[model samples]
Target: MKITFTFILLNLCIFISAQNDSINDKVISYDDKIILRLNLDTNVDDYVISSKELNIKPRLELNNQINTSFGLDYKIISATVSFAPHFFPGNNNNLKGKSSFTSYNFRFFPKNIIQTLSYKNSKGYYISNTQDFVSNWQKGKDPYLTFPNLRIQSFGGSTSYIFNKDFSLKAIYYQKEWQKKSSGSFIPSLNYEYLIFSDNQNSVKSREHQLNLSFDAGYYYNYVITKHINIAPFAFAGLGKKWSSYKSDVTKDEREKQNYFTQNFGAGIHLGYNSERLFFGSKFNYSGNHYDDNGSNILQNNFYVLLFFGYRLDPPSKVKKVYEKFQDKIPVL
Candidate 1:
């Protein structure tokens, strides 16, 4: 009886040892510092910009463009490059002009610090009605005319610190160095054509330049509805400056340049489903800037909706070979 008991005890010990060895091997096989590649993301954003000086009411426009992004994820850094391809037929003459878009985003995550650097050259069509010079030529009564397409090229960066999983603080700066550009509408046929034209010029331009900087605290909470579905809601508020120049190409003397301090606030909600193979999401955000200038309050409201889809890809043979070469150099401790 003593010999049988000894045999059973030895067998149980060997079984536990083998199980521990298996767990250790599994942990050693995965390197937390490795990078992932071949991730593709598709995004579409519909943007609306409204200001009292631009239109009687804000016009919401579908950009009708697809933005493609390619990203790489390393240990604590992620970088992505995105571009919009203009291949589809467009009916808007304002967009028929030259256009280009390129964006670069870099994210750094080291413990509680999260920082992002972004540069973008975004070109889009904008419409504004001609100012009513004569009482008979009423502004806001006519159709929304298109002219002076906007090309906003900016370099900006933001830094955020995560206090916890659901809360963070952020600061952003854009166009620190003021750059000047022209935006406005072309000459349109109104009842007072003679009054609208000066020095035989048929076009009206507003030479504009601005700087934007803001700081805000944000709260985001995620609710998991299922294994693959989740929803997130977020809100933020901040203040910034909107220094703008409003001028006419024909009459430079009749220009107005003002430095206005603006307060901004925004909120959004995101709903998405994420899985190992595919990911999709939709988000809607509304942001507004309010300030007082010359005894009148000016507010610029911007609303946008984003739809995104992404796919995951396995490492190709060439990528695997490079990864193997990198692994071979690591010394076993």
Candidate 2:
């Protein structure tokens, strides 16, 4: 009887181990496969300055341009190149002004950590609230006050950690994996950025340099609707500090320094379908930032809708061999 009892206990242990492995296997991984993606998004940046004491508000916005991005993912790294195509309808409208935008971004996912780096450059802006300043401005016929020489550039990145081991952020973001069960995670991130803003107007060149740092606490939930469908919603809030330096060619007192406190919040939702080789998704996102500039309130905001489609293919033998050689030296790869 003692021997029979020991046998039963051993069998039970084996059964439980098999069940655990089965659950883990449901999360499909495409790490060995290469993925190519095409994305389209309406993501224009805008700035607003308002002063209650002066009863004045001015809004600056880029043209309504549609941006297209191409991305590639291999092993643990993902990279993307994005630009605004001139063939888009509103991009060629002279009423808004000639504008250009380009960006490059890369992301790495290793275990529970996510790392990102990016750079963006944009030129040209217009006063979106021209009606407020003009006496008899028509809605579609009148041209906006254009800033053809204005430009802005930024270099930024973020590092985030996921607390829940079962939740897969890459499943929703990069489409490199798929999660079978519904799960959520608390993700905390640290972000930093350096920005340059310059404009040459009326032959006077003015420039500003800024450094910003922020921390955010965010919650993301992946609700599995079916084996091939899911919807994810996320939100975050953060506080930050900005250090700024301003210089102008026209003024003898050319250097000025200022510091400001900033607050930001954002929320977004994504709906996606995933299959063995194909994945597609749509997302809607809104983000806003506020800071005080010399007693005047400055607000910058972005609202955009995005659509993406991607396909996975088998990696070539040469590519796999190269990655294997480096994987030992870099465990994260």
Instruction: Identify the candidate with maximal TM-score.
Output: 2
> Candidate 1: worst 10 consecutive residues by lDDT?
188-197
Q: Report lDDT per candidate.
A: 0.45, 0.85
TM-score of each: 0.56, 0.90
Q: Taking the tens digit of each residue's C-alpha lDDT, what string does model 1 give over 1-333? A: 233234434433333232111112111111123333232223332224444465454342223344556656533346778776566443233333344567887654433344465666655533332233233544435433332255455455554544442221110111000111111111111010000111112455544445455566565555556656656677777766655555566657776667867777777776666555555667677767677767556665656566656554565677667666764673110
Cα deviation of 271 in candidate 2 (Å)? Answer: 0.4
| Candidate 2 structure quality by residue, lDDT tens digits, 1-333 | 233234434433333232111225547778778999999999889999998687758899888668999999997779999999999987777888989999999887655677777889999999988988888998799999999999999878777888987888889889988999999999998777788899999999999988887888999999999999999999999999988988998764768999999998999999999999999999999998899987799999999999999999999999998998997775546
lDDT of 1: 0.45
- For candidate 2, the lDDT comes to 0.85
Evaluate candidate 2 by giving its C-alpha RMSD to the native, one decimal. 11.9
lDDT of 1 at 194: 6
